[model samples]
Target chain A: MELKNLGEFNFIHSIESDTIYDPNTVVQGIGDDCAVYKVTEGYEQLVSTDTMVEGVHFSFQYMMPYDVGYRLMTANLSDIAAMGGIPRQVVLSVAAPGHIDTRILEEIYRGVKEQCQHYHVNLIGGDTVSIDGPMVWTITIIGEIPQGKAVLRSGAQPGDVVGVTNYIGYAATGLGSLSYNLDGYPMTRIGHQRPEPQIELGITLRELGVHSMNDISDGLSSELNEIAKSSRVSIIIDETLIPLHEETYKLAEALQTNPIDYALLGGEDFQLVFTAPKELSKALENLGSITLIGEVIEGEPVVQSVTKAKEIRLLEAKGYNHFHE
Target chain B: MELKNLGEFNFIHSIESDTIYDPNTVVQGIGDDCAVYKVTEGYEQLVSTDTMVEGVHFSFQYMMPYDVGYRLMTANLSDIAAMGGIPRQVVLSVAAPGHIDTRILEEIYRGVKEQCQHYHVNLIGGDTVSIDGPMVWTITIIGEIPQGKAVLRSGAQPGDVVGVTNYIGYAATGLGSLSYNLDGYPMTRIGHQRPEPQIELGITLRELGVHSMNDISDGLSSELNEIAKSSRVSIIIDETLIPLHEETYKLAEALQTNPIDYALLGGEDFQLVFTAPKELSKALENLGSITLIGEVIEGEPVVQSVTKAKEIRLLEAKGYNHFHE
Candidate 1:
């Protein structure tokens, strides 16, 4: 099962199985040097790259190979969701130490295939290499949006209400519980390990003409700061208005840390956050359990949260820093 | 300064400087969640990925950071060239240890920027991460080709002629000379380090009705075998007719090996190899320095090289194997 014994052609042919979800869009898939694809007429293109380095992004002690591949794909897919684009294809580049088992890679790739099938994206051609280091996975994704319909973060305007789907902070809370894991909260653990991209909500929100959108991966504060700076506007949110799952609250109590801190600083929650006209609040609620927690204001790009006593505090970005962390 | 000393936002901003080349095509580039762009109206899309791991693909002793980036871009661009496409955009994902100097990364990005400018490609958004392992760079390239005009490796007919562009053995010959650290073959060193993609030749060959095409990254024998297997034909090449640079021949003689061995077995040439109608030989001759070294025949997919001493030998794929190597 070791990759060293698996010859090159066999190793390549192994992963080329059952990967493509839509044959119509792919002219050539895995066997070619480049995967030739056709974009639907009248659609603009969306491209993004996501990389996960072992021990930096995820730990094997906490996540299986399947979780790694699934989370990696979700991370990139969420970017397309933020753009209100339809993810169509992804090409992966994977490097692992030669001593690793090929079966572990097969499990990782299985996770990728199943997730791509869930999102209806094609697993196109990719490059695989051997390295003398920890395993690395990088996926370059391609998505499509109707011409000129991309909802950029810079489109947030004053009087827009910021809304978020589902709950946040559960992922971070779940991560904190991993060290003393005793099968306490499975839901929060799933929140961290297997979060799904909000592709359906993205498409519907684009149709609903949301002013701007962002995916919550690097915590609520970082996402809010990005939207504010890009739109050149200020935002105000009530700290108590931020939604947290019941499990998140219970887990945070067990860990002896405030759940709000997880909501503001911890990440890997694939929920979506968006700014839309305040008048469309009812319409957004009709689509799902959206929580309108903040308001955009006319000022410099700064995000502030109001406490219960109406005290304002600056919400600075403390997202995951690649080099420093 | 080490990347650890440099903060995250500053590190990202450093590479985002002057990275865009074609502003018209890029609706949004580096500062967004995903890069948004427009494909030319009548062209289909080409997607491919290439990866380079430190100590696996290249070494710091043999190549500087600039050379690494330049050569990495060239490798992916060559895939586009092989498909007879015009490369338009690229997204890179790079991971390095925190102790690596930030200036070294700047040099790498500068090299990527310069190469993108050379090819008129937009240096779009990418993900940069930190790892506790060897440096890795993954580039996902996008290209465009006129609809139904791409030359696949499966199009060669029975009577087609196998041709190669430029010299074939110099890169492999140069790589072999790297171990001695001698000034004996600087040309070969450059060949291994800075090989350019044959985009113009590929485009012209496609327009001139080349039936099949492949870039010579995996040696002449492996590329020809790929074409034969894809096209379901047998190929016979005269090893004597294989072209080599004067320096390549001299280096081979000095190293006490046949230049044809390198042409048949060694890789990383980045040259163009194609099959065209035998009657188009005169037309192909006008395209400068194309060597017609072989012929396609109606048989099973096998590659045989005829020696000058009137002996036929099977040319197996002894190219670089990711796992076994």
Candidate 2:
């Protein structure tokens, strides 16, 4: 079951799919020298890339090669999702350490291919090189957004209702749990291994005419702060109203860190946070149970305390930055 | 300057250019997360990727970060060039060491952007991550070839003339100079550090209608051997006509290796080695000074010698395979 036993070609073969292809749209997919997608009407091309480095992004002992593939693929897919676009194809360039089994390499590709199949995206061409150190997997995904329908980080308006898709801080808690060698918290562990991307929900929100959007890869508070800075608006968050998974709270309590802080500044959640006009609130109501954390304000950045006791302004944004570490 | 010194935004900013956008076709190029190229009529899309790892593909002491960027970008561009296509855009992903200097990172991007401007490629979008070890830079380039005009490795026919652009083994020689700490050979060093992709020459050959083509990165003899195996034809290479750089011979003589062997088996030259039918030989006559090394034969894979010289069937491929070392 480990990647080391699954040969590369076999891994690729296992993930190949026979999806319905529109000849005019995609000239080639999985099997060719390159996956060719046609640039057609009503669509503007969107692309995003992510490279996951060993020891930095994930640990070899704790994470499976398949999990690494899944995580890396999801990272790119989330960018497309943030743009309210359907991912079409992915090109991968992987650099592996010498002496790593070819089977593990195959498993990594298998993981990548499986994710592409799940999202109905094609696995196109890529390059594989051997490295002198740890493995590095880089994926470039090409997507298509409907003309004039892109959801930008700078489009949030003041007075719009701030919304978040699901509980916050779980992924960070998951990462914390694994890194600290804490016992229990399987949910958090799963969250760390696979952060669910809010692709479908993002599309729905876009259709409902949401004001602006961004994925919460870094913690919710950090991402919200980004929106506020980019849109030049202030955002308030009802600390008590922010959702936290049951396991996340328990783990945070055990670690002596505020569960709210975890939810506020935790990273790699891949959840969508957006603001919508008052009129679109009704549409959102029918779509899902959206917890309104707060509303965008015309002034400076602030994340209000839900207890009404501590009205703290979360001015500093915290999340993941490659160099900041 | 090291990459750590160049802040991320500044790095991206330093590489921006106007050549990335062409009114003839592309809707967008570089900037805005991804480079978008409008698929023009009568053109087929081609894409290629290559990842170069530090300590594997390069060493910081021998080559500057800019040359790393230049070489990495050229590797993929050369693939596009080999396909006889115009490279329009590239996605670059880098996994930097956590403590890298920002200035050096900026130089890398600046080098990449310079190459993009020189080759007329747009820097679409890419991801950056911090790692625990040496830096890894990966580039994926998208190109366009005229429909039905792409020459494949398997298209060599019997009686076709084998031709190569420029001399071979210079890069290998240059690599020796750097690795062995030899005195200066700027041409050799430049040849090794920055490969001149035969983009224009490939386009010309494509227009002239060639049978088969490939970029010679995996050495002259190895690539020719691949063509023979894939095309199911034999080739007779004249040792006397094999073009070896003067520096290569000097380095080989010093190292006690055959210069002809270096030219035949060394890799990373990035020149185009191709085949054309006998009828098109006249048209290709004026295409620089190309040496007619051999002719395709009907029999099995074999490299015959001219003038009753000793024939070397085919040496094992001794090019750069990261895992082999």
User: Per-model C-alpha lDDT, please?
Assistant: 0.88, 0.74
What is candidate 2's DockQ? 0.39
- CAPRI band of model 1? high
Candidate 1 residues lying further than 4 Å off, grouped into runs, are none
Clash number for each model: 0, 18
User: TM-score for each prediction?
Assistant: 0.98, 0.86
Tens-place lDDT digits, model 1, residues A1-325: 7887886578888888888898889888887778899999999999999999888887789888898889889998999999899999999988988888888888888888888999889999898899898989999899999999999989999999999888888788778778677467888888888888988888899899999999999999999999999999999998898889888788778778777888889898988889999999999989866888999999999999997678999999777888885
RMSD of 2: 4.0
Encode model 2's per-residue lDDT on A252-283: one tens digit a residue.
78988788877777777888888999777767
Tens-place lDDT digits, model 2, residues B35-126: 44455566767776777778777778878888888888888888887777788777888887756777677777777877887877777677
Model 1 global lDDT (CA atoms, 0 to 1):
0.88
Residue B107 lDDT (model 2)? 71
Highest TM-score: give the candidate number: 1
Q: Poorest 10 consecutive residues of model 1 chain A by lDDT?
A: A174-183
For candidate 2, the lDDT comes to: 0.74
| Candidate 2 CAPRI assessment class | acceptable
